[model samples]
Each structure stands twice: as C-alpha cells, then as structure tokens.
Target: MSNKIPYVNILQSAICIPVSDEVPIALDIKILPDKNIPAESFFGVWLLDVSGSMGGDRLENAKESLIEQIGILPDGTIFNLITFESKVNEIIKDVKITNKSRQEIIKKIQGITERGTTSLYTALEKSLEILRKYSRTNGSLAIRKIILISDGEPTDVHVRSGEENDPNYQKYFMLAKEALEYKSSIDTVGALGEHNVYLMYEIAKLSTGKYIFAENEEELKTKMIIATEQTARIAFSSPTLAVTSITGDIELEDAAQYKPTVIRMPFEKINKRESKAYLRSFEAGDTYQILVKGKIFIDKNNIQTETNVKVLELDFDFGKDGLRETKEIFITFSSDSSKFKLNQDINRKYANVFSQAEEIADCTIRGDAAATQKIQGDETKKID
Candidate 1:
C-alpha cells in the first residue's frame, strides 16, 4: 500500500478473503484536509427561499444563520448569496469575504424579507449559473457548492401542480445534470418538514450532494451550519475509486456506499473485470465506507493447491489532481477452513445498506412518498 499521500487514507476490512466462488470486500476511505491550504479554494453559493411561507421565524432564523455562517467563514473564502420568492434576487455575487466586507454582507442578509411564492427551480437555476460562470475563471480545483434552503414546495405554474411530466419539472433535473458539468454539488435543506421531500432528495442525489431535513424551524439554523461546515472542509473534489480485477476471472459485480448517508451509488462498469464508484467531495476528518461484491472463479485443478492470489487493485482519483495513489488487494486459498475469517462489521454494513435499499424500492413501487422519505431521512440521521 502506498502511504505517501498525506491528504487521504484508505483502509480495507480484510487484506485477504477466503478463496471461494464469491467474496465480499469493503473499503473505509478517510480524507483529511490540509489545514495549511488556503481557504480561498472553497467557493459556495447559498440559495435562501424568501417565499411567503418563510415570513415569520423561518425567515428570521435563516437570516441569523446566514449571518452567523458569514461571521465564522475564514478570510478569503469566496461565496455568493441569493434569495428567491416569485423573483430571483442576487444579494451578493462573487464576493470574497474579508474583515471589511463581512459586516456588509450580514447587513444585506438581515434586510431580507419574505413575499410572493416559492420559485425553487428558478433559484437553483440562477445559483448554478453563477457558479458555472465563476468556475470558468477560477478553475476546477475549488470546492464548489450550492446550499439551498426552502420551507415549501415550488410554486411555479408548471411545478406547483405536482406533475412530474411538466417541462419545468424535467428542467429541474436537467439543471442538476448541468451542475455536474461544472463540478458543483447542490446540498439541499428542507426546513420545517414542509418542502417537497422527493424533489429535494433527488436533486441532491443527482448532483452528488447531501439532503438534510430540519424537522423543525429551530433546527434549520443548525442544519444550514452543518451543510456549510461540511463544504468548508472539502479537501478534494470529485473523488472516484476504480477497482480492477487483476486475476481476470474475478468478476466485479456491484458496489454501494454505506456511510455519510446510505444511498445506492452508480457503479460504472469499465469492463467485466473493472468498475468505478464516484464519491462526493472528500471532507477533512470524514470517512467513507464502500462495499464491493465480486465473484471469483477458481480453476478446479488449482483449487486443491494452497497459494496466495492477487485479486484486486484500487485506483483513487482526485478530480483535477488526477490519480493520487493505488493499492492492490490479495487473498489466499487454503484447504484448512480454519484460516478463513470474516469481517463481521463489514458484513453487517452490507446487509443494512441493501435492506434499506430494498425498503426504498418497495416504498417507491407502492407510491408511498412519505414512507420513502422517512426511510431516507432515517438513514441520513444515522450518520449524524
């Protein structure tokens, strides 16, 4: 294992697995930000919903939270703030925070009031536009994030009817796709349990971001801070893990991420023997665990011989930084069954992840949106 990389660490559940028809493997990867790195590398666009529903404590709390976030942001951090109701308003644009501008930004946030209906999609569209434009001059290494906070469903004519087929609703997903093009993830916070849960969840998932539910009005501030803090700690952007079967006969099957929120990850198959899993931005002091399943075909004649076999190779890619390191995994074949040992912790995690996945699927098929949201919310809380 190459340990030269100081920013990230990778750990596996077992160095060896029993040589059988199929074996499971798990990797616990931890990424730590270098404190010496400049904070200017982080860029954020915050979308605050000022729809009429946000008139009272909701709006006030949001303002306070935004102000608090601004106050705590390290000097030289680049951020933009936008508020939307029936119209999209850009309160600040491409502002790099410093001692002089911090107080000015807070005053602008405090002046925000609520009116009109929620233009959720419009707000998202505008924010992504700003980030996309900024990325052109600033480059891709910066940690780009969009934090959207809303207390109610979208009130746009095409989306308010709850029709998925509406062109505007489809456009919402397209916006998320566009976000990926700019290497930006949209983290969403559904405040007061009234926002469209499925919409918030899907957009965040599609963008490889987090979806947080502030169950009550008071929790919104905390959740917003949590989201901001996570983005602030991003050490590496667009991290991907590529697994290759070196032995040719070991067919890589499926993979899923079990930590930092349990959701099925899109496992891209490069070939029958190789696959890749794209992870969200890596944050300092945060660990991500992934479980990969594979099938190994042992030669009938060779199975009788006790030998060590090289099974898999992992290549870690850190966005614009390219492939940082590689690790190879091996397993042993032996006639003595006593040599076989199982990593119970990994097994349990695999079981729990798949179980939750199945429950989500069933809920979706039954058109139980509430149940699906509940399962997702419960899984998210587990990581907290």
Candidate 2:
C-alpha cells in the first residue's frame, strides 16, 4: 500500500462572478491522516540578501529578525542561512542547532558587514542544490524553502560581462520552478522596495509561498517575523486536501456580462430527491463557495500529498444534478493582479493552521538532527 494522497481542486458552476463590494472567505478542510507529526520535523533555508542595499537598519534588522527566528524552530527542524552579495555566502551551512549553536549563528550574523551587490541567482541555485541533494539522500518527504531577501533589482550586482548569460535570472527561476513542480514552496522578502514588490510576488506565487514587502526597516522586521511565525502557527493540511483550484478570477460585469445563473450536474445514478441539494443559489451582490471543501492532491507514486488550500468562488449556481460529473478544473494560473491580494488574505485567515504545514515542509528538508541554537533578538522583533 503506497502512502500518498492525491486530490483535485475543482471550481464548479461559474468561471467568474461580479460583486459590488468585497467579501471575506474562510477555509474549512476535512481529511483522514494515518498518524500525528510534530512541527520541528522539517527543514528550512533562509536566503538573506546582504547587498549594499541591505546596509544600515535593513541589514541589522534582517539579522536581528533571523536570530530571533532560530530560537523558534522545533526540535528536529534544520536551518541553512544563505546570504547573498557579490557572491552567495553559506553563513551557516546546514547547521543542526542547539541553544549553544544558536548563539554561534547569531555571532556570525553580527560579523556580516552588509557590502557588495545582490547576486540572487547564485544564492537561489545553491539553495535549491542543497535542497535537492538533501531530498535525494534523505529519501523522506521534505519541504525546502528558497527564501530570497532583496530590496532591489539585479542591476546592482552587475553580472560579469561573460558570466551574465551563464547564470541568468532564468536559472534561479528554473530552480524555483522545480520547487513548484515538486510541490515545495519558496517565500521571498524584499525590504524597503515598494517598487520591487511585483518581482517578489512572482517568486512567491510560482512556488506556493508568500511574499512580504516592507517600505521601511520597521515594516521589514514585522513582515519577516510574520512570515516565519506563520510557519509555526498554521496546521490546515492534515485530515483533508488543500489546493488552490482557481488562480485568476474576474467580475461578471467585467467578464462578458455572462451571469451563468446555473449549470447542470451529471451523475450515473441521478436521484430526484438529491437534486435540490445540487442547485446553486445566487444573489446580485452575494458571494458563494462554488466548491466547498474540495479535495485536491499530487500523487508522488503512492505517497499522495495534499497541498493545504481552499478553492472558493464569488458566484453560486442553482441547477439540476442531471449533468453532474467530477470536473478537473483546467486553468493555468496566469499572473493575475488580484491573485497576490487573495493569497495574502487566504494566508492570514489560515495563519494558525500554516504552523502545521511548516512542520510538514520541515520534515522534507535534509540534514542530520542536532540541537538548535537559541538567539533572542532585541525585544523589538515582535509581530504586533
């Protein structure tokens, strides 16, 4: 018997709907897991950008936030700190940390002077390489994160004339692409870069991770703390299938004016009695969950793993079940301008459950289990 769960994210009834005002959506998943897992059984990588742009309060705040994060990891979680500048620095290579080792990592964070230009490509390549290598050797489910923290574009790094084409941004994307292809997540944080928020958002979307943009040092720390803290607080993955079925959505008025009042459902053994339950109801300005608690997963052989997500819709349908059939919602997630906003809301609503997903991702990261280093930041990194 293989140990994998596979499900599909389906958006039934309508492709798009209109709303005069915005509404909130909550997630509710139901599943059956074999056993219990701890949050610490995962692996994570902190890819910090130490370019000239990261100087002063930005760099200080980055290190300060990281030091505080190290103390929060669970017992078996492994952390690799990758800082990038003119080159990628393995500030702390796959360190199995304890309270004592945590102090050492903090000491190294202090030694960083924050000089040179940003080399995001190299750092991402190295981070993915480590993740793949560990995944290959460990032979267990792991969640590897390629966390890139940058405040600007690649212009500052000035890719070498000949080397420019050698390790281009595409290469880092390929690694990021592979992580997404393999059901892993990649989160990015760019401090003091409101103009560069779009780029960070792309990286996060491609890898099923979240991106944070901060315009100042204070917001930077708060965002960073929130992102990491989320890893230890959310747990909406077990006992149910969580996958985002629809990536792009539009208002009905904006969408060719097709209300799609109702669609038919198909079933081999259609029962007239259950027909009423299948009819979707719709109102002018009301939003509905087209598909509620829909199960979706990826099958890695028999290890059916489910991505914790909910596929909701703003439109509802009231139709006969005669045409009801399981649909494989086929829609490639294009770069929707609204996706970033929806993703952030979804993340915040399920922040508490995500802590559990972090545990699942951590178990997949490679490295020997060692004690964690304990480093507390100046009483200021709190995410109030």
The residue-by-residue lDDT of candidate 1 on 194-313, one tens digit each, is 776667766776787877777666788877876776676666666677888765555554455666556666667787787887677666545555666556555444443356666678
List ranges where model 1 is wrong by over 4 Å: 1-41, 157-170, 249-254, 296-305, 320-323, 333-345, 357-384
Model 1: clashing residue pairs? none
* Per-residue error (Å), model 2, residue 8: 11
Q: What C-alpha lDDT does candidate 2 achieve relative to the native structure?
A: 0.46
The global Cα lDDT (0 to 1) of model 1 is 0.70
Q: Please state the error at residue 300 of candidate 1 in Å.
A: 6.9
Worst 10 residues of 2 by lDDT: 368-377
